[model samples]
Target: MSDIIVFGIDFTSAPSARKPIRVAAGVRQGAVTRLNGLMALPSLDAFSDWLAQPGPWVAGFDLPFGLPRELVEHLGWPTDYAALMAHYAALSRAEIRDLFAAFCDARPAGGKFAHRACDGPAGASPSMKWVNPPVAWMLHAGVPRLIAAGVHLASLLPGDESRVALEAYPGLLARELIARRSYKSDTKAAQTPERLIARKDIVDALEQGRTRLGLRLKLSHAQRDELVADASGDSLDAVLAMLQAAWAASRPRYGWPDAVDPLEGWIASA
Candidate 1:
């Protein structure tokens, strides 16, 4: 009877029909129940619509929320969320590439950009950083939808207790299970039998409730097969994030407050 709905999002900016957003749902019993198979959402609009539906829900988004404080402050960008979103959205991908390249040009050869303290501890790349993954654009594309849907960010303490959003890093959970075994194969060519076995191992552990976080992943047989079959871990990543959100949801003290430093930002595990 817990009214909280849990969603785990596997996000992408250029998602297509074949690899749309993957979402997993869980409901609270004494422990969490993995209600059904993961759902594939076509776009942010569809995601927003789903979020706006009746019922209190908490979502674990697999994208970064804010940029590193150092980068934002150094670049003299607007710090407010609304202004930041506008500034971010207005820039084209090419512009972003150029700006980031220029920023790197100003730094020492080895050190390109300043990183937040949390980045090292949480093992997350800086949102504004463009090198390994363009996480900044990921934040740009993803956070607005959460805002539009009126979800409360766990990092930004909201007045409403019903709807909650938490920034979740799927890597943290994946590392716990596999210890750097490369369980998720993003490239289709890299998908192998061993990777599939790793996915199954992780899935089995979750279904059996084998984490210190105190929640069990409930999935139907078909759901289990789908999750294991996804060598890319897109679906599995969403499910991992969902569990992180569920763990945060169980702890009321972890609610996000408004004073978060946009530059330093916040990390889910940190």
Candidate 2:
């Protein structure tokens, strides 16, 4: 395997050893990418420490790296990507909630969010949402760590060349393989056989190289079984993100569009 590594992060804001950030790590070898390991960062602090380590690696993190441009401009936060993140990093979560709530209240009912161009295609949640996926919190909890670690966030900002971060959304890939099909649930009571079958279908398609990105997933028998058995789909999402990381590694500009807004970064494989 090459010294260069790849990672996919399934993040949690309130992390612990019991429910830490799930990471899928792997290496790309020619046409096949082998998923070599799965691990966790027990807390956000632990996650930060890991990012600070020196390495030549590319990672696809399942979190929004920026906010809506309109929102930023409206709030008069820094328009520069790095400056905006710095400003965002300094805010308390409660302050974020209050500010974003007022912004939404000023907008029409059906159009509460100011979206980046990629969101519609990527089918991602608004980075400002505080509930459900809580991606705003994901941005709050995750991006600052990336910035603090001094890693290059591909199109967003330049930092360490070896340690590159790209935003990834596994749901984008999963939906391509199985449209609008629910594959996994965080709640044990909600994990159904239908989702299980959908997960299997997605796995089968990836192995067959059926997706547009055109990279085959290589997994051991046990790894395959373990991914398939996770009712929460966290493991599967990590793998999907790993595949996106693999794709990003193989492309120019990390597969981002040529004209992405600097303040509103692009999502990998969106």
Candidate 3:
């Protein structure tokens, strides 16, 4: 086993005791990636502390690290990505909603939300969307903490060398294995047997190294069952992120294209 700690973080806009941020911690060796541990950060403070922990580690976070270039340009926000993040972090959620809404209001129909370039290939939610996934708020909440943690944001922000953070979308990897089958939900009523089965299928595929990522997941029977039993699927999502982190560790620029938009960060392995 290598000393390089790899992580997959399933982030939330609002972390709380009821639905804490979920994380999967692992280490990769050759073609096998082993689950090292799992954690929950019930508050942003806890998550910030986790981000500040000493590393020799790299993490995959399931959140957009930047806004749409078009939106940023139209809003006349700072062109530099770090400056833009700082500007964005200063606003309240209400202000964010209002400004983004106004941007959409001025745009023509069917193009209400402007998206980052990587969003198209990753099938990700628009970073500007305040509803549904509320990823815009996620960017507001999560990105600033990353900035404060001083962790290097792979191709985007340069900070601590030992701790590298990459933007990851578990859906990008999950769909490669299971297509569009639903695997998880937050509501009790939406957590069906079919979803449970789908989660199991994903786990099985990872263990068998069936996906194009070429990294097999290593988990004890108890760990495997625990991942399968989490009806909310946060754990599974974390594991998916972990796999992506593992894939990115030794790659040049963490597998991102050389021409990634500095204003809009690229998703790892997309």
Question: Each model's TM-score, in the order given?
Answer: 0.88, 0.96, 0.98
lDDT (C-alpha, whole model) for all candidates? 0.74, 0.88, 0.92
Backbone clashes for every candidate come to 9, 0, 0
Q: Where does the lowest 10-residue lDDT sum fall in candidate 2?
A: 1-10
Find the 10 residues in a row with the least total lDDT in model 1. 255-264
Ranking by TM-score: 3, 2, 1
- Per-residue alpha-carbon lDDT of candidate 1 for residues 56-88, written as tens digits (9 for 90 to 100): 777788888776666767778887765776687
Clash pairs (backbone) in predicted model 1: 34-218, 68-263, 69-263, 69-264, 154-256, 155-256, 156-256, 157-256, 157-257
Between 1 and 2, whose lDDT is larger? 2
The TM-score of candidate 2 is 0.96
Identify the candidate with maximal TM-score: 3
